[model samples]
Target: MAKSNERRTNIFPLALVTLTGLFLVNLLGFIDTQTGSAFGCGRDWPLCNGKIIPEVWNTHVAIEFIHRLVVLADLLLLLFLIAATYRRYRGRKDIRILMGISFLAFSGEGVLGAISVLTDNPPSVLALHMGMSLIAFTSLYLWTATLRQIETGKYQRFDLQDASSVKQLRKWTWGTLIYSFLVVYFGAYVTFTGAGGYFQGWPFPTESYSQAKTALLIDLTHRLMALILFVLILRLFLFTFRLRGKREDLRAVSLQTLILVVFQMLSGALLIITKLNLIAFLLHVSIATFMVGSLGLLGLKASSLQEKERMKEYNL
Candidate 1:
């Protein structure tokens, strides 16, 4: 019984990590699509332009076709993880809840892909597709962490004081996460609107602000939110440093958050400087995803640590 339970407990975190890797690959596919590489394979869904292999070689075709392949792989991995989890934790409410979410998210991603192709690659649908993929990634991430705790015998319960602090942190962290999403959406808008190619220069349109208001607005909003996040993370680090009785886990999370935010900001600026080069753009997207994931992990760690501390106090 103990051995079986141990095997079940270990599966969730491993599955979650696999899911995150797949999510990263999918984001790469999105970047490829945005760069006009979606039909690189000549409009073939599972094959390269109706051939097992294409006789003609082109950058766009290679990118688009590879992206499709990656997505297919991701789907397979997710399904396998779900099946394994169900086998192990079929009756547990928490496992069932996460499995349901994972299933729904995978379905949504597939629908988005079909819609993108059917709509002749509509930008709105494509962008929303990427967003839904992120949701699926995040769900798996959370579930994986939960499983890790269970395996390590480190799962902690919350009390009133811990709950209050966590509530406050949750509010701030969630807000930051939402703001990050908006920044990513605006990036998609920049691509869809052809705004990146418009200015022909860095940080300014060729003409006055009034003529390029929409593009300018999108750029400005993303920049401003980035600034806000940087400051907010800086503040969080300071607060964590100053707080009495701060757990090691909380401090570690704060430090990691600060590092990720700085890297994200730098990557964004580099993308601008490179004039939206494909590699730069992908890096920007990847870093943004990383920031979101890190912040989420930090929030969870803080909450769990606080709960542990509270339990300790009560015991005393």
Candidate 2:
């Protein structure tokens, strides 16, 4: 009975639910954008068309309204997660820092979203919105992954990793994470500017790019960056996989990151083949979101392992 009670102390379930809820909210936000429902609420903040329930409703209004509702619910869940995590793991400074970043990112998402809606949805604002949503989702993901590791008593295995491997992995993981964020921002910009639809072919533009030269440039830049990101993730995965026997956690995250990047690239091609189908576009964005989260997770694990190595070296 005492052992069971002790096991129940971890908040893994709550953290998982909160993370899932936030991911759903981010997806819904993208759906709202793809459907041209940003102004469905008519420049209103927290109120749909000047009413709490939106008296008049259409498909656009419904999508935007539903997105707002989901965001509100996710906000509540994030607050609960923060409070619960603090109460249970207040001694862990790293977890507290993760929670703080999660809270700030969530708040930035809301603020940026509101500003975007009220300002007629500028392209830059919308792009920033995309990045902020990913930030919020990724931070929550790291928090949840950390809690699970602690609950399973697997975090101690970081000490098993050699200092050299930990140092190399840490550098690569952090570099990939930063580069991934840049790729996300560039992709988001392409989407917001409608540059993705300007292409006549996938992987290569078969038609003349004279008409939409600006879009062509934007889309081309994004594609180049995404390709580079894919290579980076692939390299990270291979290096981490080689050390799987020592750091399984890092290997797992790197593998997931590689898979998600592969799917994201495929979805981008599908999006072009389907003439930018809404579903394909959403899938592309969703995969990118998950890939970013996995990269963040890999970076977090690498950092933890490096810290463990340092502690061992210091004989503390």
Candidate 3:
């Protein structure tokens, strides 16, 4: 009975739900940014037109209202998660610290949303908002992953062979994740700034590069950066292959990371070929979101293993 009670105390399922909800809210915010009425609430934040709910309705208002409701839901759920997880996992510094970061990220996301409603929706502004969303998602993810690790009683890699390779892969994975963010952000910048929709070719080869708009140039740069990011992921994939015969978990992560990067690149190409198709855009962004999450998970796992190895050496 005591063991069951302890198991329930952690509230793993609740934490997972809360994190998933947070992701959905962030995704909704992106959707709203892409197709929303910035002035839907008429310069009135916390309340639309000083009312709990506006009497009139429009496409913009509806989308914006849904996003607001989701954010409110996230706020409520996050508070619950903070209180519950802290109580259950108080002994774990990692979980405690990540929960705090999760709270801060939730606050930042709210602030950015309110600001977006009050001001312009430029690509750069949206990129900042996206950055906050990414942080929130990542913190929650690590928090969740840590809890799962604690519950499973498997915190570090036990598999054989090269410790140095795992360490190097960790560095490479971290670098890839950061680089991916920059490339994706630049892509978003070009997107909201109206810089890349006109290029009709598959790989963005236009008739005259010299006579292109600034948006086209920016778009080209974004693509170039994305290609570089892909190569980095590929390098991580090769590193993982070295451990494929030994450690299944690390190798699996690297494999997924590589696969995601390939699909992301293909999706980006399809997005352009389809001439900025709405579905294609969402697909690209969705894949990028998950790709970041996967890469982040790999980094966390690798770092934990590295720390464990150092502690072992010290004890030895």
Top TM-score hit: 2
- lDDT for each residue of candidate 2 in 1-316, tens digit (9 for 90 to 100): 1112254345899999999999889988998998899898989899988899989989999999999999999899889888888887676667878898999999999999999888878889998999998988998998898788666644343454386887787898888898898899888888888888877587876656677877877888888998999899999989988887778877888888898998998898998888889899889998998899989888887786435533443334
Q: By descending lDDT, how would the candidates be arranged?
A: 2, 3, 1
Model 1 earns a TM-score of 0.80
Q: Assess every candidate by TM-score.
A: 0.80, 0.92, 0.90
lDDT, candidate 1, residue 241?
68
lDDT of each: 0.67, 0.83, 0.76
lDDT of 2: 0.83
Off by over 4 Å in 1: 1-5, 9-13, 43-57, 90-95, 154-160, 197-207, 210-213, 242-245, 302-316
Over 54-138, each residue of candidate 3 has an lDDT whose tens digit, in order, gives 8889988887777788888878988888888777667556676788888887898789778877777656778877877887888
RMSD (CA, angstroms), candidate 1: 4.4
User: What shift in Å separates residue 283 of candidate 3 from its native position after superposition?
Assistant: 1.0
True lDDT of residue 200, candidate 2 = 59
